[model samples]
Target: MAVSKKRDKNVYKAPRNIGKPESENPKWLIPTALTMLIVGVVWIVIYYITQANYPLPIANWNIVVGFVFLGTGMVLLTRWK
Candidate 1:
C-alpha cells in the first residue's frame, strides 16, 4: 500500500488582473507615429526623385536619417497603450 501526500493550501499565487480596464494611450502617440512613417516614406521618395542629390550633402546619410526617424516612431508607438 502507498500513501498519498496532501496538497499544500498556503502556496503563493499571483493576483489575476481580471476586470481591469484597458489603459489609454498617450495623446501624442498616434500623431507622432504617423508623422514618422510619413517622413520615412517621403524621405525615400525624395531621395529617389532627386537621384540622391538633395536633402543633404551626403547622399547616403539622408536614407540613414530617414530610417532612424522611422524606427524611433515605431518604438514610441509600441509603448502606447
Candidate 2:
C-alpha cells in the first residue's frame, strides 16, 4: 500500500483597519441622528399624553414608557459609532 502526503492548511487573517484614514469611516451619523430625533419627538408626545390622561397629581406609572423611549434614544445618540 502507498501512503499519501497531506497538504498544509492555509491560515486566514482578518484585514486591519488600524491605519485607515478618516475618509474611510462610515457616514452613518446623519441617519442615526435623524432616527434619534424622531424617537425623541415621539417620546415627548407619549409623555404628554400619558401625563394628561393618567392622573392630575402625577402618581401614575405609565410615564415610564415615555421615559424608556427617551432614554433609549439618548443612549443611541450618545453611543453612535
Query: Best by TM-score, which number?
Result: 1
TM-score of each: 0.69, 0.35
TM-score of 2: 0.35
Candidate 1 displacement at residue 6 in angstroms: 19
The candidate maximizing lDDT is: 1
Across 6-76, the per-residue lDDT of candidate 1 in tens digits comes to: 99999998778766657878798899898998898888788878999877768689899889888988998
The residue-by-residue lDDT of candidate 2 on 37-81, one tens digit each, is 676567556557776564333444445555655566676566444
- Cα-based RMSD of candidate 2: 9.0
How far does residue 57 in candidate 2 sit from its true spot (Å)? 17
Alpha carbon lDDT at 60, candidate 1: 89
